[model samples]
Target: DIEMSTSTRGGLLKGLGRKLAGESLFMTTYVCKSATGMITFTPEAPGRILAFDLEAGQSLICQKDAFMAAQEGVSLEMHFRKRLGAGLFGGEGFILQKITGPGLVFMEIAGDVREYDLAEGEVMRVDPGHIALYEPTVDYDIAAVKGLKNVLFAGEGLFLATLKGPGKVWLQSMPLNNLAAAIRRYIPSKG
Candidate 1:
């Protein structure tokens, strides 16, 4: 007896949190009464799907809208950066999604994906939008790109994201915001 129902998964507060994190308020759940059952999931955009099996007490912080799905026992919560600089210029804004585990999770990364394992105290600076996911052990911050010419004309924007670590990081070659900006010029305007 398989049953399906849709509602705000963690009640109203959690649903509201999900909404603030740029996801739909209600979630659909499927129950399997028999011994085994199968289900499929897909991303909303053309991208690669990555699966993670998380241990109890583990957590992964991801870009907003990157979450695809997760199994039971996983919790999706809001993550906020304490620094005003990160909130103002981090590309992802302040509200990111934090998925905690004891179950499997799926994330969608736009375009090609690259992985990096940073040793302790190692740092990698990146265009903020390219950041897809990272382990909680990594320190995330934003640095103002030095030099007036580079900041104004280099086209990398005012601030670059700084990931200092001893943890893994995943970056996407194409972020949806970049893709939209690229084609925006070709779009017809009312004017």
Candidate 2:
């Protein structure tokens, strides 16, 4: 159990850096009153994500995956994409973002973020980065419609990332460009 308190001073609070097994604790840096904090997990790592709603003290499970991370007081669940004809039209994908409560989210990213708004009944097609974190209730699926072949091919790609109705989506301004840049800088070029 870790105890953290809010600091009146601004700028992100420093990380506590305490590790534990299956423990849920509050993150002071990203937490806020109106919105919840977010966190991301990487592959081949082991740690249990936990959250608690102050209103009820109800604990929530963040997610179970090597590529998963969590905030102190946020909850998460598995959301499945609906299948279409022969289950081939739509692919199987899962979004482990947020479930309930408003706080803060901690994300490990390569660059800054960019965000967009989707009005009620409005759908937004994004390239993963456009979505930092979102509510678990929203529906998602691969936007591989047959008619818009040109749009898919020319614009982005075959897989059009779609998010539906009434939730906040955070997007990173720069995409995976940073990863490639890092590799180029560190790894020696072989002539």
Candidate 3:
């Protein structure tokens, strides 16, 4: 039903990079030779599918493993935090997914979703793992949890993602990792 155009140059490098990012080594492109055909990708979890259009010269950053599929011309790569502290203590570790395109991309966010449009200088702090995706225009950083009681007892981790935006941000109510941890607690462990 479809044809794929393979990259002849640097194919091995791209495949290796994707593998290090916890993705499949090969990215397949589907083309419909027939008059009518459709290509579909389904989310692994039962959650919302979010679509974003990336214009030329624009890019977006997403949580690792969030990328589902994209149009043929889009490019996906790894993005790193510049600060050493962020690399050491940030929620997503040192690297996130960076997508650049003049096309559309679909990503999956677990559970219900909330979207906020932030004006310049507006700031919101969120649990790092809950962040779905954000525009490049937004400034992202990590903040230490405040107060001894809250930091130690809240169970929300030592750092929260601080997003200062003049752009949009998407957050998910339930991250799949969180759900998996919760479920794991109930299952009887075999010694």
Which sections of candidate 2 miss by over 4 Å? 1-95, 99-104, 145-155, 181-187
lDDT by residue (tens digit), candidate 1, 1-191: 67888999989999999888877898878898899888788877678999999999999999999988888899888899888888889998999999999999899999889999999999999999999999999999999999999988999988999999999999999999888888898999997
Sort the predicted structures by TM-score, highest score first: 1, 3, 2
Lowest lDDT 10-residue stretch of candidate 1 = 37-46
lDDT of each: 0.91, 0.40, 0.82
Candidate 3 error regions (>4 Å): 4-10
Instruction: Give residue 161's error in model 3 in angstroms.
Output: 1.2
- For candidate 2, the lDDT comes to 0.40
**What are the clash counts of all predictions, listed in order?**
0, 17, 0
Give the Cα error of residue 150 in candidate 2, in Å. 3.9
Report the C-alpha lDDT of model 3 over 55-170, residue by residue, as the tens digit.
Answer: 98678888877889888767887787787766677667787888889899898888889999999999999888888888889888888988999988999988988899799899
Total backbone clashes of candidate 2, pairs 3 or more residues apart or in separate chains: 17
Model 1: colliding residue pairs: none
